[model samples]
Target: MRITTKKLVLCALMTAIVFLITFTPFLQIPSPMTQGYYNIGDAAIMIAAILLGRKVGFIAGGIGSLLADVVTGYYIYAPATLIVKGIEGYIIGAIANKKNGVPSRLRQAVAVTAGGLEMVLGYFIYQATVIRMINPTLGMASIIADIPGNLIQGAISAVLALVFLTVLYRTNTVKNLLR
Candidate 1:
């Protein structure tokens, strides 16, 4: 596909936005036991995935999430962020591309599922590889403890994405840009 300046700018803008949102409370937080950390950045990634297709979505999500990690000094999570966010975007975009139903609902569901997977997988990778080496068997508890948080994040992101998309769909700016 021929890349347009508009698409490139759109991708970069959303990536930076996601990175900033990752620092905000509306985004995921770092803690072993905190359940229900809502990540608004995931919604941004999901929106990009739904609108821009898988390749673009994955690039945006991966880069944005990595930048967030760097800016936040969460280097331990950077590798996982890159891989997991890319997967999340690809998963959501793939499902949306195949959808033949209530596209909005399908997009929400797909995005949430993708976000959940990203959190869970990322936590597992980061803990097992980095955290657990320092404290053995701790990774297991870390994974288990994150289940609720991942679920909560997923649910919140889904709702937020749905609402945001609904509003954006109504606007001529998003309609022209996203479509």
Candidate 2:
């Protein structure tokens, strides 16, 4: 697909939205398990994917999350966050926007589930391997401790995305946005 000015603007807007939502002081809930904090940025990422499609989703999610990590001083996890969140956004958009028009509820559900699982697994693997390698002092126990928080984050993100999508659809916002 050819890139247009409109698409570029939308992607930039979405990226800013994701970063702002993620880094907002009140929105970030500090995780008791690890240095990571849970935020609703994933909700915006998923919504962007479902609305704008995969390419925009990947770019916005990856860069936005990367910026959030850097600004938040989680430098160690920035690379992993970029890859993981990028893939998560791509997966959601690819599945949810597979067809031409607005996605069916089943498709949206599957997309969110698959994307959320990808995020959870991606972070788990990243923390288990790369994080362990970088800081051997952080043991497996700490890695395991992070799972529940990630799972909760993913679940919350999924719910928020679905509810937002439902509202957009009901209000015909999706129709206008797609056009």
Candidate 3:
């Protein structure tokens, strides 16, 4: 695919935004369930998906989240973060842009909900199986305990994303530039 200067620039900006948002110290709730902590980086991921299309969202979300994981010294999670965030971004963008125009409120809600669930499920699956394999002592019970934290993280991110998106939608400036 030929890259347009516009797309290149937007992708770069969005990627930077995602990285900054993910890297910055956000409200983190410590989970007793596992080594993982819940963060609101998903809010930024949702915003990127809403502003950009699927391809750009996937690239920005994946690389940005992967970099965040590396920078945060969570290197073990970088690979999973890449795939999970990429899929999350793609799902949001695909649902939001379903009509090839302005996304409806319902679509936006669906996108956020699905994307949030994707993140929660993706990490859950990774931690439950893959991490369990790395450490045979890890039990399914311990992994299952993380569900509540993940659910809380997902819910908060969705609310944050919805609020941000709503404000952006109201201001035609950003919306116009996105188009």
* lDDT of candidates 1 onward, in order: 0.71, 0.88, 0.83
Residues 1-179, candidate 2, lDDT per residue (tens digit)?
68888889999999998899888889898876656788988998999998898888898889998999999998988999899999999999999985667789899999888998999899999988998888888888988888888888888988999999899889966677666
lDDT of 3 by residue, 1-179 (tens): 89889889989888888887788766556566667667877888888888777887798889998888788777877899999999999999888884466678888899999988998899889998788888788788988888878888778988998888888878896657866
Clashing pairs in 3: none
lDDT of 3 at 73: 76
lDDT of 1 by residue, 56-173 (tens): 6788888898888777777766787788888887777777773442366755676667665776677666666766675565647656777777677666776787788778767786
Positional deviation of residue 23's Cα in model 2 after best superposition, in angstroms: 0.9
With a 3 Å backbone cut-off (N, CA, C), the pairs that clash in candidate 1 are: none
Name the regions of candidate 1 deviating beyond 4 angstroms: 25-28, 33-38, 98-104, 137-139
- Model 1 poorest ten-residue lDDT run: 30-39
lDDT of candidate model 3 versus the reference: 0.83
Give the Å shift of residue 148 in candidate 1.
Answer: 0.9
All candidates' TM-scores?
0.82, 0.95, 0.92
